[model samples]
Target chain A: MSEQQKRTEIGEIGEFGLIDQISSKFTNKNSSTLKGIGDDAAVFGSGDLLQLLSTDMLLEGVHFDLSYMPLQHLGYKAVAVNVSDIAAMNGLPKQITVSLGLSNRFSVEAIEELYKGIQFACEDYSVDLVGGDTTSSPSGLVISVAVIGEVQKEKVVYRKNAKENDIICVTGDLGGAFLGLQVLEREKAVFKENPEMQPDLEKYDFIVKRQLKPSARMDVIHELGDLGLVPTSMIDISDGLASELFHIAKNSEVGVTIYEDKLPIAKMTYDTAVEFNMDPMTCALNGGEDYELLFTIGQNDFEKIKNHADIATIGYVDKRANGLKMVTKNNNTVALQAQGWKHF
Target chain B: MSEQQKRTEIGEIGEFGLIDQISSKFTNKNSSTLKGIGDDAAVFGSGDLLQLLSTDMLLEGVHFDLSYMPLQHLGYKAVAVNVSDIAAMNGLPKQITVSLGLSNRFSVEAIEELYKGIQFACEDYSVDLVGGDTTSSPSGLVISVAVIGEVQKEKVVYRKNAKENDIICVTGDLGGAFLGLQVLEREKAVFKENPEMQPDLEKYDFIVKRQLKPSARMDVIHELGDLGLVPTSMIDISDGLASELFHIAKNSEVGVTIYEDKLPIAKMTYDTAVEFNMDPMTCALNGGEDYELLFTIGQNDFEKIKNHADIATIGYVDKRANGLKMVTKNNNTVALQAQGWKHF
Candidate 1:
């Protein structure tokens, strides 16, 4: 290839564009692969059930900063985040394979400490640590985890299943993890400015923990199963709530209208946002990494989960021509925008 | 957590040592995970059959220098190596997930070129491209792939099954890939020193392609089954012949005796080694990344496969007390040594 032909930028095509270009040329030949490449996890059909597979990679400087991030929390976060992808497909994670590339700067004990948190997450999620590869890197650390999960054929969910007038629901709360990251960054800056100053992180512990050790909403998935309800469409909130909403809307060929008054924001998350002079509503809409489940349910199926403690109805699916909109508490309407994480 | 504690160097323990240290602490709780951490791939007992899981990571500088390597070959090699691990387990690869970390230096076109090679490998290996994550990295490219394969319960082979008097065998030829890398490195040095000179890689095309596009020996694995022979023990020849032999011996509690004259060396590889003034036998024994299957078969299964063109009986397993030794054409015995690639 000539030098001029090699100078195109990845950002020009964007992430989704690149994925479309890559996935378009391949065809799945195996009958076992019932679904591939477009969902939270690839679904494989066994005789009586479906097996889910998903993988994620975390780079050192790009994904986390060692100065503020504890190795154990990083380990836990890695497992939890990958498990969240499996949960998004309404599956129970059974096993995970973690591969790590480490530099000599990491000691055996440091690696042990990281594994300790990995073990904790495994136990918490009822998953097994099956296999992994560890090798030396020239610089920094790289972690790639592949998770396997199982679900019944009828229980599996996809992003393109939402219907007209379906109720959009979100579990737990949003923006807390994003707010938590903001607080950690502020404290990191304060510490860097003066050697004598110590980070006063006690008051912001909830948000910080949300950022470091966020849990996947496996409880919501189980409860929905118990209630005999399958979400019309589903996705986990990793790349901000608005971005996920756009994904569901685009894939389902529908629009969404979310009520700000119904948005679930933690008290601490709201107060911290106010302290930082940021809009709490915007944080809930655009803040990411919450690892919470967001989905839409058929109108008749809503009665079963209406009283669930952890779930809240935030909106309803509408015609695409109506567009995505948010209703403020004062009855004013505004267009919803997604400020997704742009790594490039 | 104290700094006063002494640190243990990873080199002291080596790659296997570090892996043993880490894997020993974690126990598998999920019944689906039939085996973990010790073999070429983890065995999953889903039902009547066994599922094999294997993962490998290739870092930019540590694994390959992009300056001399094409992105497409890098992509193809990544998938092939992971598939080779599955082949080592005597299984049929069914699916693979590829996660890539891209830096700003890479363009969308460049990524598409990489995926072109990936799709070609997927087609060649008959594996489905399942799910994967695409994220941006701070520096160079990182590709991590996890492969899923299947084998019958009775057909599965492990590294610990070699017995006394088992015949050791290797597929295809050895040392070509390593010598190919040497030629490429020499050409790279010439190009770096003088920008005017173009690399004359045409003369070394076969060896160079061996280095860049080594295919997994799945065909040999399939052929062995047709011949009604199962390897008592098996491993892929990635970390040189001697090191891999040491692995089988250590795991199986046996020793080996190989003949230097019996080692398979391609004509081109032999001539290139001679041109480089390196010992051809040494190159065949210690050179790595052949992507060839090395196995030990019971004496009863020897006649069934001896006539096959690609497979060769190189040696036999011995008692642990005899140790690993090589017999020269002159009837001189020498202790075998392994200097596998050391990243540290």
Candidate 2:
């Protein structure tokens, strides 16, 4: 407790390193806790089924800018992100608890508008808003959401079960959300320079919606269930595709080889990347917050989803010695890197 | 959406009113969600047993001051308060997820110190640390904890089931935690005015510890189970005795009458209240953050706990027409008013 004691800055370790350092100190004490601290959601037992619990905390200024982010969309995004975690485990979300810390600057009507979006997400996802705590904050708004979901024991998927030669697939398009953020930031800067100028956003509507309100790919989960396919490993693309790929590769003890030509990108996302003078491929690889599902399945199961318009088989799992690599459209090989969102 | 629209301040409706306003908009969509929004914890059927879910959020500056409050105790208290909500439903806490938003000011060692307390609480309560999110905050520290517990379907208790003439009981002592806060605040002021002077806290150690490290009454829960005693209604005392009394009265549609002479106050708490020129009785009635269990048992069940040392019978439930009243030592009756913590 002395001032002279050595101090290690949190930024040095970063968020993931900090989590590893803390989670390593404790061990699970309950038999019912099937898995803890390493997956998209914690797994537990409930009779014949397995239950999943996941939580996410979003703070103002850190997660979103209120000047451009609507209160309703923020609320909806909060729920969607938690639901994405549940879907990562191939589980169906059933209940959620939202805790909010509001400063005096907020009005009751504003909070109601926030909850209106929450209610909309609840109805759309068919999950119940069960319990939560409302408290005061000294500065800014903080929203923390915890969701509970369930999956049959046989259908439960984890991030550590990918096998060599497994087909890697990603649902929906990527990089749109990140490009949307670029547009919003650019527009904000322009407005600040001249307050009288009204923003022209009609041309960027698709990418803007992707940033403000991205939906969880529950449809992909349902389709996979109907196709009788269980992914060997799965994760959601919240910290960009490359970072999520790193997670799966590390946990599964396998290497990955993705093809740049096979990566799914919407027209608007590619155009926005060009407009910003950024590489579209880099944006697709590292632009996060798309909330799409990334999974690996047995090669035999590839045919089941190959014809599906929403899913794209972009890569294949390999031996650990191969590491993670990407094959460019111009026949060049490169190492995959992750430049995820770094709040610290 | 207009500048001319009326803006209702959150303070006008208060925390409870805001919760009620928001929760009323959402309806339960899942059959597994047996109960929601009104209880200390939400109840659902996991399988044969009922499951309970609850969450609490604590923000720095609003909930605690790091200038005096230790990081370790804050971590322990965060877990204990959430566990107390589980105990209120007569359930056994099995797992908890703790999400933290830390700023750059907190060092790695400081975070480790905080987790040490979290680990200690997990060991003491026999609950597993499951999964959580660690993100950076723009300012201060934010902690959001979600707990899941289980109870037999028949044994689960709710706040609205108290019958007329039920004996109202409270466990442990009251006002100590509140008085402890007052003592800490006074000492903090003294130290602020004169940095060279050491705080004279030895005499107030008992109450101070009560404030810093209040334990959840899980021992009482186990004892009740062993004695085959199930209270008709139950709740945890977090927002003072009077506010909790109002919840029971309003939910159960019953009245309450308690004797002031029967209120239990620790000697240290009473002396501290007197030292601070505050009424000890008012402290017991309105001072919050006690984290004790409050319940009402049937008359026939009272005999089972009559000889218990920690439990005290303070009052009895009455017809709704009687309203909530307290009889003072002079035998004068007065309507009880709740001045619970107003955070907004």
Candidate 3:
């Protein structure tokens, strides 16, 4: 009856695409809203310093399946992800509030288990669990966490602060979480086929742990602060390396050139990828949920962090005209593309 | 074969019973956490003032039906409900972070409609929209909002602060929102039964509006501030008045004696309740979603607010030995029972 029969699928736009489209339409009108929607955490202009706030929601079935995922690990990951956002802003997280939608399926013991992990994360990050709401949901579990952190005005890092020739650095190895997920899914399928068969997850424990309990890079944030180094641009690798890199490149008005060989991948992760019949390089490029810090630094600061074991130089910022390209191990240049998680 | 197979239904315990069971388990570890998980919001000690942090989550089907609920109203209601928590704390709301989980069913235009309402609430409260996460859900829409507000150390009110002999006061009126919901549900049924019939809702505009687009009691907070009136204890009437009164009684370790005659009700709400064959008195006591301010003031401060057109003195706080009772029109004393929203 109507001419508007066309329906645009969200999967067509992708997560990053949808974010770009939505964020582009809204402009921050409040003076206190220093930054919005573009960075890992939004920065607010507090009277004395910049206050950073970040929020994240994790849903059951989509984000994590409760059958294989422990309630405690889910709680820990929820807090860690929000902390990761604050860390991406180069700020020290001080407080967090967790809101939970608990279905009737969860017992008192289950909730206690969840809060146990939440308390553990609070102790680890030195954040105060200030406030939260717990209510019943009709189905499934929903956990939402909001973290508050503070950074000095001059030290606050944003995605748009990168300059041309700045070196790109990423903390820890990539692709491990993705490979770990693949291993778990494979084991789950096998177990489903034959209930008598047990999942031999012990051998792939490293990658499995990476997927289940990834830590926020607060240590790196503190280290950089102690060393008097501030990142020129920064974002957390929640939506894969290439997607985050594109965010930096687009926001900072620059192009990036990376060496594929320089990308950090753990040996176990690479082995697991091969076992799954997938390319480790592709996994590293496109896998989400890494929760590692990706940042840009000035050339002069490179000498300061060169010897740091946790930090690795993966790329360099380039002029916008140069475009985003990667030099392969065999000395061949290729255009870099990002294919992030498509939950829609 | 195990003894742990005993499954208990959560509906048996009800929402308040479930909350009481859960709240008894968490002991506050942070010295800055003055109050946690007992009132409308939690109170944390900041250097010179108290920081009020509150969070809420709304799930589709459980909290709202999209067939009758507009996306814009959902967003506004989400913010308003969170801000109402701050109002209950006798605090001025400062900032809010909203996290949304949308299925592919939501179009870009739909999401825009939601944000427009959020922006409207932000402007109304002079609060900044600082940070949030936007991601895809598996099935239904999920909205979670975390709000932060501040109050002077001495001015901050808590549910535990009501003392014996304090006068109970309520802002605006009650039972309107719940009556409005009844009207909406009836219309929805009518539409379902006859597809060609346009729902006759003209006579029930006020009540329907109360259900659809309720405003937070920020005006009460501001007026109290201007009058230099710090309530002895405060709570927003999100749940029915009876339930909230019980909360004050339990938390403050005092008994409440509310006058049934003094309970404020709108004429339209009362007439509509009668037309629907619902008890207006029961609706005032146990019907919820009013978003009105229910609070207690010291006896000495009564002169300051006695002439306020919108506020009514309902009753007074009694000793714990007296218990919670309502004085009926026929001079009969009855115990007040709280029938809060039960999701299970």
* iRMSD of all candidate structures: 1.2, 0.7, 2.7
- Candidate 3 is graded, for docking, as medium
Specify the highest-TM-score model's number: 2
Whole-model Cα lDDT of every candidate shown, in order: 0.90, 0.93, 0.86
Task: Identify the runs in model 2 with alpha carbons over 4 angstroms from their true place.
Answer: A1-4, B1-4
Q: Is the docking of candidate 1 incorrect, acceptable, medium or high quality?
A: medium
Cα lDDT tens digits for candidate 1, A1-344: 98647767878877777787788888999988888888888988577667888998999998888988999999998999999998999999988999999999988778877888898999889888888888888788999999988888988999998888999999999899989999988888988898588888899999899998899888888888888888989999998899999999988899999999999999999999999999999899999899999999999997888898889899999999998999999999999998877777
Best by DockQ: 2
Q: Estimate each model's TM-score.
A: 0.97, 0.99, 0.94
Pairs that collide, model 3? none
Q: Which CAPRI quality tier does the interface of model 2 achieve?
A: high
Better of 2 and 3 by lDDT: 2
Clashes per model (N, Cα, C within 3 A)? 0, 0, 0
User: Per-residue lDDT for A1-344 in model 3, tens only?
Assistant: 35345556667776666677766655666566788776888877556566677899999888998867888898899999999999999998877878888888887667767888887888888877766777777778999998877788999999998999999999999998888888889889999999899899999999898899989999999899889999999999988999889989999999999999999999999998888889989999889999999999999999989999989999899999898999999999999997777677
What's the distance in Å from true for residue A143, model 3? 1.7
